[model samples]
Target: MLCIKKPSVASSFEELIPKILTEGDLVETEFGERTKEIRNTIIEITNPKLKKVPEKYPLGEKAVEEYRKNLLYGSKNIFSYDYHERLFEYPYNEERINQIDYIIEKLNQQKNSRRAIAITWNPKIDIEVSKDERGSVPCLQFIEFLVRDNNLHMTVVFRSNDALLAYVANALGLISLGEYIAEKTNTQLKSYVHHSVSMHVYIDRDRDYIKKYFPEYLKYIE
Candidate 1:
């Protein structure tokens, strides 16, 4: 199973910076070389502790064979075209309003300090294809969220985004939501993500960053 935990605030971004160091990392693959390289670079950028380049990347043929089993895969089940069409066609409707309410309810039910978020980036339905000379298909969904200590945090999801191009916008959007929810709840809103394919890929990209610059985070793991 894929597990994504809430992000607890650090005393400061700098303190959080040291936790992403990279040392003694190991991954071997040719097919995954680009992914691994991006991972390493991100670690290097965030954590200064590693000082040296990792040796396991751009792996040997033998190493790739050995690690093949560890590679990730996803569902092949096809969706009704209606499924994809609806996400774009009726993004904001009564159904979506209920969904936002449901997420708030889930947080209230948790009885813990953690807050929840639902991400709606199903790749099966949200593929980005060129639309025209002046424009293109929507790349991601848009949503708003707020964090408050004892109130329901608000989050709004948008359709279509260029992952790298719009990363900052998405990040800030969630942060704002966490803050807003916290104020409404009269308690700190702990940040969380609802899993969707787009988010999955974003996190994978983030994982690469953590591996490259924040290996110390791996140590904090249990």
Candidate 2:
């Protein structure tokens, strides 16, 4: 039920942080976790307004472009893909699956299908207790897409989501995915619904920064 609608990334990121902080639960993550205090939460972008990104607001142009480049590929960058194993590294295996292509094909064939789910978490790979040394395991769990009334909407789920840095970018990244599929499916991009079990600002690291940023964003939201 925590949701916000913004016309651009520049405008949206500001709004998302506050929601995470407000709606988030003060929980602690498991051992080998990066930070101390965590906020487990959920967020929804009722309207992504991808139409205003880059060209219009641009936000942090250089940074956003770098991020955009990393995410645009069908391959992995700091993000994810490949039930195709597109990434050369990671668990260091060869088998793969193109989730993007799979979802696109599913929607192309059946517009009303609920079977359009693409998952990134592998129980064997992700839950390996011996692989504790690995730096990245995946915060993203899966993404589902639905088309209704000629509009394509996305539901994004995450096992652990970073509140400040990763929250907005993750939403934007998924929005990009939804946009791509919508174009292929010939539907309008409606919105993005985001659920993060851990949508938290790392309190020990970001408390001061988060507090400072809040009042400023508060005014903007007010």
Candidate 3:
């Protein structure tokens, strides 16, 4: 596993971009050729409060805010499988479960609880649909909230993540979610850990941009 520890999201993003571009292995996907890919990448943000968006990142504050809102709230039009819907209104056995509420209540009842987890991949729906038919499936798979020493820490797992295009915004949205949870649970927000099974950059799409902005790191790539 590749591990990256950073104090803030912006720093992590800065470090990760070059690492992925230089060290990632060439892989082919349904979309196209990707420049780099690292399996089982783990990113640990020691301080979730320092949520500065990198200046070079394409999205601005407003866009990040919208993404966070969509993540916490619901946006059916934006995503085929919205994270909010999966978390807040999970379907199972002809019933719906509000996982977010469950996590909050669990932590409130027992701060040391390890069972407070929310899962996005519903096998009933996710396994049945074909990727070609759906166009996009949920990349985020699991989320867990833990309260230790009066601080709330969040960990999320993704089956696949776009390291260059989507990681920064995704981290911001998750940090917002963690803050919301911390507020509800009355715990100070602390670390944010992100794990990705496949963290990749779309080379065919962003090669020029990488060459233009990160020319120095190109030496690491073959």
Candidate 4:
């Protein structure tokens, strides 16, 4: 019997994780069977105890503020990728780097308590890895994060997706990224996602495969 229950706002994502662990059955997502495994891991790390749920799961406004404070004061653990480069890319152009510096300086100049954010999500410019490519895999990537009251919230971006086949992977990726950023920045990460409309074209075609392994996946949004 499936005993899964939805989480309440009073509890954080961490608190909900255990319900997923003990009461929740692994529901298939577009991504694949791996979703269950990853979800299980997230719960294990967030809430070690299933006894009493925490008041805040850390995905709150204040949590996001803490994270930004850390980024401004400590290391910025930003991760990026370049499909064309076939590896992680660094130093977003000199101009971009300069902008970051400028923002930092401006924040101090104005004596402001907020942070500046720059994202990489232009499909036209960002390189995509393709399957037919003789040398690399075909994929799309981008980043998204939240900022409230000038405090940087959690950010999550992704590379590659099977809108129907691997939707779970995408969700897990975003959620995990939010958790990590929240932990590092000491803030809560609000969630958002961007996807290709063309993905539907492919997903519709693979309806059979999706239904066979991921029957519960479609129930996600429905």
For every model shown, the clashing-pair count is: 54, 5, 1, 22
Taking all chains together, each candidate's TM-score versus the true structure is 0.32, 0.73, 0.92, 0.36
* lDDT per residue (tens digit) for residues 102-157 in model 1: 44465556634344544444454345423223323443343434434443433334
Point out the higher-scoring one by lDDT: 2 or 4.
2
Lowest lDDT block of 10, candidate 1: 40-49
- Residue 96, model 1: lDDT of 35
User: What tens-digit string does per-residue lDDT give for candidate 4 at 94-184?
Assistant: 4233333433344434433344333434333434522223333334343434445534333223343333333333334334444554454
lDDT of each: 0.33, 0.60, 0.85, 0.35
lDDT of 2 by residue, 1-222 (tens): 455555555465666566655554455555433342233344556667653443222133454444445655533433323322422122335555566777778888989889888776766666673266544566777788998887898887787766666655566766776787898899988877777765556655555555565644333222
Top lDDT hit: 3
Misplaced by over 4 Å in model 4 are 1-132, 135-138, 149-160, 201-207, 213-222
**Model 2 local distance difference test score:** 0.60
Ranking by lDDT: 3, 2, 4, 1
Candidate 3 local lDDT, 1-222, one digit each (tens): 689999998999888888887778888876556558899999999999898888867556777888899988887586557888898999898998999999999999999999999999887777765346545678999999989999998999999998877888899998999998899999988899999999988776876666776778666654
Candidate 3: clashing pairs of residues: 35-203
Candidate 3 local lDDT, residue 118: 95
RMSD, each candidate, Å? 14.9, 5.4, 1.8, 12.1
Of candidate 3, the 10-residue stretch with the lowest lDDT total is 128-137
